[model samples]
Target chain A: MEQWKKQWTPLLPERVAEILERLPDDAPLLEIRLRCDRPLELVFDGSDRIVYGNNKAPIVEENELKALLRRLTGYSAFAWENERKSGFITVGGCRVGLSGRMIRTEDGVLGFSTVSGVCIRIVREVKDCAKPLLPYLLCGGRFRSVLLVSPPGCGKTTLLRDMIRIASDGLYGAVPCRVGVADERFELSGDANGAIAFDLGTRTDVISGISKSDAAVRIVSTLSPGILAMDELNDANDAKAVSEARGKGVAVFATAHGADGKDLRLRPAIGALLDAHVFERIALLEGVGRLTSVTDGDGLRVDAVSQ
Target chain B: MKTIGIALLFALCCLAGVRLGAKKAAPLKMIRAMRAGLQSFSDRTASGATLADAAEPADDAFRERLSVYLESLSQGSAQADAAGRASAAFGASDAVRSGAELFFCGLSDAPRAELQRRIEAFGAVLARAEVDAENESKQARVLRSAGFLVGTGLAVLLL
Candidate 1:
């Protein structure tokens, strides 16, 4: 723990630490907003979602966020989770939601490229973020495959990262599962110096620098991990891999981008994944990192009791 | 001794006449030669001919005349070496001695009439050198006189 503390302390800038320190203790995650002349707005929901902003906001897109994560983490490949409407990185368990550009692909209409105004909602986990959602996630002493959905800048990834951490650390009532993270990008751990700067969990096996689809297949078959965490399941290959992982009884945690329930179905990739019935839960994150909606695998809305 | 004095006097007179003539003619002759040399070199270079191939019969005549003139100057004074005589006759100073030698050598096989004309021109220039030296001294005296006049006028005005 001391070694980890020493390792991570140098990796994080003083400004980032100051921002992290300003976060609310009760909040699952904290947001640090950057604006010109506008006071930094830090918003923390009781869940593992946080939103930081200023009044004069810069436009951020799903591709832009993916590019940022790629630059920040030096990940090789990036893709938009067209089916779930999210942005995926090849680094850590970091999934970011993107808001602009929907183009046509051979596999139908997936968010092809990002242009103009866009917002990237970066997902991460705080210790207390997954406390409420953990119980429902672990049913009959086993994990269920879940798909987190959110609009741009929502806390789907933050919630998912926390869920994975909690599950791996055995914070919830369930046993500590070997969480295999196909972090195509380094958003979750934001790893520097080959070590995870940010904590995912003790037992989580993070495989960075590979496609989510490929990592999913490898982890399910070879690693035989208890839970597979991947970000931004966009393409048909990604959907197929996730379905295959679920078929082998390996619980999968994934995120996607969308405005609402209706908009999610409009996405061709997400629509197909839904048809395939790969996920048991479709958790919808909304407004400033709030879990506004939660639905079961059948697309039926379920009430989430506020923490 | 009297014969030697008479010869010396005659030589001085001859030297003065040649020098006077050279003062007027040497510059023109040098200019003409330079122009001719440049034209010849250009013609040869353009025509893709070697120096030997480019040497016309008239050029050979000029070289023969220059050599005879140099030989005559060499006969007048043992004090003047072959090199000095060659320089005076052919306008081939130490810097261009090799070129002068090559020119004369080319003419060794040419006709005698053309060679005599070249010799006369060379002798005339060599004889004029003493007179040109004397004229130069006279010009320096004139310049000094002019400078002294100007200085005296300035001193008088200041007083």
Candidate 2:
């Protein structure tokens, strides 16, 4: 109840709050998605259930969606102008995706003019989720650069986040390092105050609200981090940044939306990096829990029982 | 001596009535000031200033009142919404109050195009308010002038 109260209560309106309060403390809620003037639903266990619509539930007005957006953004549309153009904003330590017409100038996207839909993704910190991956991620008393491979929604981001925390905190007799996390989307850290909104451990530096490749290069040059972590690398720019960091001898822990390590080898730029042996260990995330397999730099699976 | 004292008193009373008449005839001047404040706000906004900074009026008195309204917004109390805040800016008329509120709210976080539209709408409302005030002032002037003439006649008769 406290967990639910801490995460959601202050954000919901009175009517929505009342309805959510009626449910049990453990609701197994994944998301609360809304498209303007459309039905509101709760995403749990990969199913969409109506959030508020019964004889008891209060009917929502069209303006309610608009009101929610203002509240979530703290009524500062000016500050979030860039994020709106990108079609999302991270608020209340959760990710809120927006969709609408694009606003662009000669330079690039400015922001959204009108937001019509919102998708709220609820993120929770799972303690010790990376416990099993530690041995494969470390070798000969040194941290090995790891790349997590998984398709979308396979929970790769969550796993990488925990691993960063574990590395920063030096859990399970491992050495602690000055870890740098480039959370480009503000998704992994949910920070606005120049500090991480989540528990990234004492030695972790989380920088967000910037382009992915640029952030990576900036952290590598300026932060002097012992290790680097990033979420969801795509395209040649990201591959180049990863190679740059690896050249600087900063072990990189990152995630990519790929089903398997060999699968990623077909993509030209990424395949080039793989061929160059940039990654020492690869963990391919399965549906929701433990990784399906952890492969070494040679693209060979390692035995869990071995040293 | 007593006769002279009575005559002097009558003259003083007549002068007071004339002064009242002059005060009543003064036109509603605030309408122009309000329009000017909005113009300054727009200029500031265009220069890439935040709404709070842009809405900071050039007039010292208006700036003080706006600060109070801003403080209330930051505190996020139900007691003071945008409408309540704008009430302190213009006349007590609901039209003026609502228009001011709409203008202020637009300045808070609106896009540039939206802000421009609200500003224009507010300007129109302000113009109407100016006309209304002018009409009222004209009627007040007529009443005060009539009072002055009547007082003069009464004083003349007394003397």
Candidate 3:
């Protein structure tokens, strides 16, 4: 079976799974969206289609969605409580984003009261995706701090994962060094039952199922990594952690949600890192593993500079 | 030869009474084992283990009884199917069996607090059942003794 089918099919209704299994082997299936009383939607490469059952659109019930959530979490909501708070569950490197009623208190949001919709993002590893930009990222045989910025569904995580693998494995003439991965949601590590599904290279040390800041600190202090890699640098705390690690001479490899560097500067958290020149290079992705441009710390195009 | 035949008849009656007595007490033992196993399952799951990983029995007896269910769950069998298999493997009374069926069916369908509450509630039910079974077993013991005595009396009269 394909990776996506093996990882995701069991988490869906049987009817839906049947429909998904019928898809061609080469289908570029991207996302599977399930909404209560709505037709099942399959997002392919740059397109989407509503699936039907018995000649009519398959309407999912609220109970089915809940059951699916239960199955995805291996029937232990408590085990996945942290992921629930984040409104997503990471399974085998694929993220299942959830939409539901928020349970809030005077303190803050507690968790979901009910899940109404689910979106499973399909993630596939593309080896050597970062090979093109490795030259700019490495200078004088030392890895430079690079932050990948892209819009949602543009493959930032995929690219970041490959870069980590290559960096840790010493691929393409890059010297192999210790890389510590703070896989807060288990996305980078694909950890299931304490076993890692992804090949993050033998030299990589991944600390998962914990907060990024805590994991980063623990990884740095204990693992003594030469490169510290993390995903989704969204908040000030994350930026602070990355900055602190960089200050300690660990090269930071991270990804963030933004259209480009300009969009990134609008966010005060990441903007602070940019202003402090925390990252030596910023790669803006156009699409899946496709980099539109690479810029230096001062926002100058590295390709242009080389020319 | 007649005396030996009479002795064999009395022994058979005593064996029958003992077997009946054990049958009457089986449910209590089964329920006790289930309660202990469920408690372990609840604690392990609360500590972030998956259903299959946490489905450990408290002792050897329950472990042997739950082997089929555990194997099924670990192999990714549907929750309902696994629970069914467990229910079939348990040769307890109807009431105890039904209660266990409810627990296994709902195991994977609720939040932690809800699940914990349900387990406690089921445990209480089992506790009450154990008391009832003890009282029934006491009655069964008397009946079993009387049955043995009555059968011996009949054999002696026949001789």
Candidate 4:
């Protein structure tokens, strides 16, 4: 078998380009999908370094490659060594599953050691995936709270970001309203140096590096923004903040990782929000970026074709 | 020899004291001038006064000096505008076009000096704006606090 470095090195640029280029042409109009929805397994040592996996084996020495991997993941004290063979860090929102030596304790599995290999999956964000649903959202001349649901790497955040840009650009109607994005992770803006590089819009106010709940309150009260956006809604505090924003009449767009609408409705805080009718539309993304189904408050299917 | 070394040290200390004193005085003077300039600008702009209105009260000699400066600025702006339009029309890259446009549009001689000077002036304006915003918010807080105190007092008296 070819060495991991030899196989991956030549294909790295091509793979990156493919991810960026394969974005749905009718993004915002169609659902942007991920090619692999399954979580990729990542094997690492206690130091969070990549071990090895897939075609790659014979993991690199920790001393020589650990520093490089640290720079990539931005997290220290984590290392992966799969079966003491090969390893590399995965990019974007792709899952990195663990393997190798298991350190089991009475409480639970403490950690993995003597790592073997890892599987790196690529996650891509296609633009304009939500374009078809824009009219339905803005049908009443007022924006509604939208909840986008999908499993991991399903392009929920990508759809949300485009929707924001669209709303800010006023692509559907008048001048874009003020949008406040509470991006806890640097995913939406992809800003490394604490400033938004892209033109989200003149009216967009981005407060990166803060919890969604805190950002929502700050934007709503201080910025007096019209719309609020966030990704990975998990906590009760986040739900509470969303509820408060809804009460204040601010439109919200958020995404979460879930298998289906029913699965989404089962989450504690998420279920509460749904029960309270926090979101006007629940869009279910499936099979990568395909929009499998969309439902209204009554759980009735809305057969709106996306462009 | 020890006596000589002590004397030399004293002389060095005296020299250092003089140098430090001079350095401190210069910065203090600059700070005072900056404060005075800010105050003058604020006073002129206050009470519904425009830049033109403020300039009107100056002596004829000052007005003549101002006119010459304004004329030079206008000519510079004209040249800049021509360059900017040409670059834009030629469909140059964004970097080139923006650089040309900013050179002519953002640096027009109305504010005086060259591009670098205008940028410095803009920085000062931004600083002043921040300070003004801070002061306004502070004043609002004071007013709110006073209102709260009065309301509490009134409520106590009514009870």
Evaluated with TM-score, which candidate comes out highest?
3
Error of 2 at B15 (Å): 23
DockQ-best of 1 and 2: 2
Candidate 2 residues A51-143, lDDT tens each?
655653434444666667766765545656667777888775577888767778899987776777777777777778888888787765457
Best by DockQ: 3
Model 1 lDDT tens row, A118-139: 2223344456776666555677
Candidate 1 residue B111 Cα shift, in angstroms, is 81
Docking class of 3: acceptable
Taking all chains together, the TM-score of candidate 2 against the true structure is 0.70
lDDT of 4 at A212: 78
Q: What TM-score should be assigned to candidate 1? A: 0.44
Task: Report lDDT (CA) for all predictions.
Answer: 0.54, 0.72, 0.81, 0.53
lDDT of 3 by residue, B95-131 (tens): 6666666666656656677778877876777787888
| Best-matching candidate per lDDT | 3
Worst 10 residues of 3 chain A by lDDT: A298-307
Query: TM-scores of the first chain across all predictions?
Result: 0.63, 0.88, 0.94, 0.67
Per-residue alpha-carbon lDDT of model 4 for A14-101, expressed as tens digits?
Answer: 3322332433433321111111212122222111222232365333333213222222333111221221122222323333332346
* DockQ for all candidate structures vs. native: 0.01, 0.18, 0.39, 0.01
**For all the models shown, what interface RMSD does each have?**
40.9, 3.7, 2.8, 25.7
Q: How far is candidate 4 from the true structure (C-alpha RMSD, Å)?
A: 24.2
- Candidates ranked, most accurate by DockQ first: 3, 2, 4, 1
Q: What TM-score results for chain B in every one of the models?
A: 0.28, 0.73, 0.75, 0.31
Candidate 3, DockQ score (0 to 1): 0.39
Report the CAPRI category for model 2: incorrect
